[model samples]
Target: MVIFIMRITWLLVASIFHAGPGGYLQYVVYIVTSLGFVRQSFDVIVDGIEQSIVEAHNNLRPGKIYVNNGDLLDAGVNRSPSAYLNNPAEERSKYQYNVDKQMTLVKFVDNEMGPVGSFNWFATHGTSMSRTNSLISGDNKGAAARFMEDWAEQNGVSKQKGHANSVDFRSLHLSSVLPRRVSTIIPEPNEITDDLMQLASSYVASGGRRLAASNITRRIRSTQENTAKFVSAFCQSNCGDVSPNVLGTFCIDTHLPCDFNHSTCNGKNELCYGRGPGYPDEFESTRIIASRQFLKAADLFNSASEEIQGKIDYRHTYLDFSQLGVSVSTSTGGQQVVKTCPAAMGFAFAAGTTDGPGAFDFKQGDDKGNPFWRLVRNLLKTPGKEQVECHAPKPILLDTGEMKEPYDWAPSILPIQIIRIGQLVILCVPGEFTTMAGRRLRDAVKNVLISGSNGEFNSNIHVVLAGLTNTYSQYVTTFEEYQIQRYEGASTLYGPHTLSAYIQEFKKLATAMVANQEVPTNIQPPDMLHKQIGLLPGVMFDTTPIGTNFGDVSSDVPANSNFRKGSTVNATFYSACPRNDLLTDGTFALVEKLNGKDWVPAYDDDDWSLQFKWSRPSKLSSKSFATLEWTIPEDAASGVYRLRHFGASKPIIGSVKHFTGASSAFAVR
Candidate 1:
């Protein structure tokens, strides 16, 4: 009988889910046969392992007290002359983001732990995704940390926290080595038991206060009803606990009520049936705060998941360096041969649509009791797992954010599987733009991918842009949507013109990737004529800001250059520049670095905007950090190569040169 009841209950629950959002619940019946703990699904297990790795790191060497003062993100080594990261002067953060696709905080290891140099980049596990918790994969509990530690030792880095100020939280971000100490910046975790106790006290106090008033009103009503029964003149059934006077608001009926419990409520309803007007409504205030916080974190976690998935690793760190076009084969096959590596990637992950329960099956049949979290019961073997190379976006913090103060991020969406021989990148972007709108989108994504690939792979870059997905998921779609039209703000993910624009730019990426070679550019332009001077081509960059108001991120080039709060409103790009196809001479600009002291462009007003332009250059070398070049006209005399400036809500008037007068200066031959 128990078994039968359980089966019936399961069927009922399945039916309910099917009726819910996205029509995906019905599939649950087939997806999940048993409601017990499921350990299969690689997607579900990756998160837990990541967390465990973080925990192990904290256990071994806490983060703090590093020997160097340089930025950890830019740290480099002088181990090899061929690798850029091997440069002696580079900082840690720069090395992480630019070369290793990470953001590391150094935590030198101390000698107190086990074998000194037995690991690199060890992960830890923790229950939360908070600052101090171990880096866990979604749903996977401790597996991630264990794997990370093992992987580190395998990589031949010092596993023990050598006598160094260890435990820098960002040290986990290192691709090569785990920090040697625990993180010093982690906040004390909120105690759950204490918080619950406080909540209970508040709930009881409010409950008591409301109940007292309700009792008094009920007592008086009951007495009046009793009095009406005593004074009944006509033959009638018993008042049935209600006095005539109580029933008739105008009548004044009175009586002594012996039982005190049922005297003051509304005399009819539950709180009112035997109570009075002032009864507590049983509203849970603590629940309100707790629920909100939980939801916010969940949203953040989901967003993080998306970011993790989007990470596109291009640097062939441990793989055959030659595969990235670093070297070609000399076999008689006469093929454009590249070298290969001997590593197989272990578990990888991606983000699913977070649209209601359709987002994912977090629990079996949506049962809260069975929170089918990503807990790794086992860590399978892939002794030599390859690193999934990714292209990452720099993270920007919005002041009015859900996270606590000093929140940080870098846009590496998901960890993808390392495929064989070739790779593909697909984007479900937006469509439609004013004038040659699609043009910019195409060039922008293309340039980033190309540049990123070049930096990572070294030779032929492989990338493809799949625009015009038309899933109705938008990208700041405008014209109709941008004009405050319904759902335009969120629906248009990028904007209408993104589809066509990316389509064009991706054409180059696809060509490069498939051809297994960099698509060289040979286009040269004539100098501006003394009379009929060709307008020097300019490109605009969209550094998607903290908010969607378009206030922080929106600006047309040549107008608003003072992304900083205050300098001087000089040369300004028109906020609404009419698109001109003729001037769209294939120039591009992308913000590779926007967080340095030089890039910081704010004064009193925190909100700011800035742009960089990309043009062809006459020279080429390995040290050039930026890909932008300029157009030189024959008669067009040399001038200060500059960007315009604007202030806090100020208008632009003139250009702002990097140097006093040293910009794009040259004498024609």
Candidate 2:
């Protein structure tokens, strides 16, 4: 029953939070993926663990320290060597990491327990999904966080001390963008007005928040209503019987895994079993059924555990992986000094996953015996000659780490972080860690804490690896996986011992914390701030069509109009250059509700269901337009609503200026 609820909750998240412009098509793919089904259950288990921690430490002391000071997100200079032309050094200084932007204070909530909260603050780096997608988007992780923020705001929790930043609450929004093959795309539907769509989105966002808030019990109850609503609305025709053929063992003849039996896999790989698209596939169905039986059989441990008093502390530092060496445990009963190579990827990195197969004649999960791969490897791998030998078995395709003249191709300077609250410890990894690598790292951290010289830490220390955080360093796979030469293995930039090296460094950190000693400072990576560059030019200028003024409402819902359930609302405006002002911390548009005598914000650009699209009427015209839209769900309460657009215009030689567009009042009944 718990597993069933978990899968349904994932369906809600995939369809709402992570939905790109893909909409129904994307929904179908995710709902069917077996990976989503299984991994989502794990997410619930993690949540249960978290809830246990909260329940255990009900009366624990609130933390006095708030640690949101790492690289949260900043629009800084692109310091890649390729960004510079004539004078790389001079142009680079234009974009160095400023002290002000380095560690920003986004929001501070002073409470009786110091500052005890963690907002769904967006992670400041890219993931493998981001590297492949062309459209600008927040990965599933960020999208989930965005949903939490939006939901909190709607429920009057935005700035309320007891909401997102509660004195005794902390939530970890894990990314479940699954199937490992396809990317979730947010779609822009032209059906409804922005305000109506915002209302519809409130339904979904509220569902996401509930899902985030659930443990084992709450999930079971919430899933029935929320999941049914999502399927009814998004599934359209198939409603209750949507086909799960887009992924898993059912998706035969596709590039993704189809044989859950593992009979066809070369090495009988466990990863090949029941892995692919769709929820409740054969493997998942069986697991869910078994879980239900277990829940029925064991009622003794059903209640929440004793409250735990968790401590909240975090430490962050910079590490240069270029030449860092560590003593790794060896099978021969000794430790070996293994140094990480400069960042680089192999030929197989381009051979995308089975869910979304890549171009060319390449296929992943295969050895490098292919003639073409060998030829490409010999040609591209040998030219650099700088340090190709270090990242062996990877068949170095791009020696980005060693290439320095133009700009640093890959990051040598990366952020390493450890977040602790009570017995829960999160190793905030800056790179993607393969499944095995993550497990090993988690165990290593736990062991280090346990083996502290004086055993000063808590007896029950739990560790989880949170990857692709703070900064994007790329992939980290184990030596065994790296030798396999699959996409993840090839993308393991720092070489075979990357995982081992990370474990070693984390152990050192654990030891320091245990002994209550100051952390040792490592060599700083090269400063790209003075050497980075930006290729994309800034916005030139903005102008409306000859007669229209900027922010003019070109089209909108009728004045004093009424809309019904399952309808859409839309508004068009004479939009300006979006680049003129990125609106980093603000909204491009808003859905406002008429409350008493004043208007209240209901939704903004961050809402996935409310879309703001920018386009030009013609190729030769400098004028641009934006069509803001929303799809009203059946449950939207009858009320008066309006859409507002915020835009920016840059004159040829003048500073950027802001403008506004408002729609006529409308009613949803």
For each candidate in turn, the TM-score is 0.16, 0.60
lDDT of each: 0.20, 0.47
lDDT tens readout by residue for model 1, 2-40: 000111111000000111112111112112322311222
Candidate 1 to truth, TM: 0.16
Regions more than 4 Å wrong, model 1: 1-497, 520-669
Q: Flag regions of model 2 displaced more than 4 Å.
A: 1-136, 146-320, 326-336, 354-357, 369-386, 413-422, 453-455, 558-561, 594-600, 617-621, 633-635
Which residue window of length 10 is worst by lDDT in model 1? 231-240
User: Quick one: best lDDT, which candidate?
Assistant: 2
How many residue pairs clash in all the candidates, one count each? 151, 40
Q: How well does model 2 score by local distance difference test? A: 0.47
Q: What is the Cα-based TM-score of model 2? A: 0.60
Model 2, 266-364: lDDT tens digits are 332322322212243432322222222122111111121222244545555678787779787788989888788888777656554432334465534
Candidate 2 versus truth, CA RMSD in Å, comes to 17.1
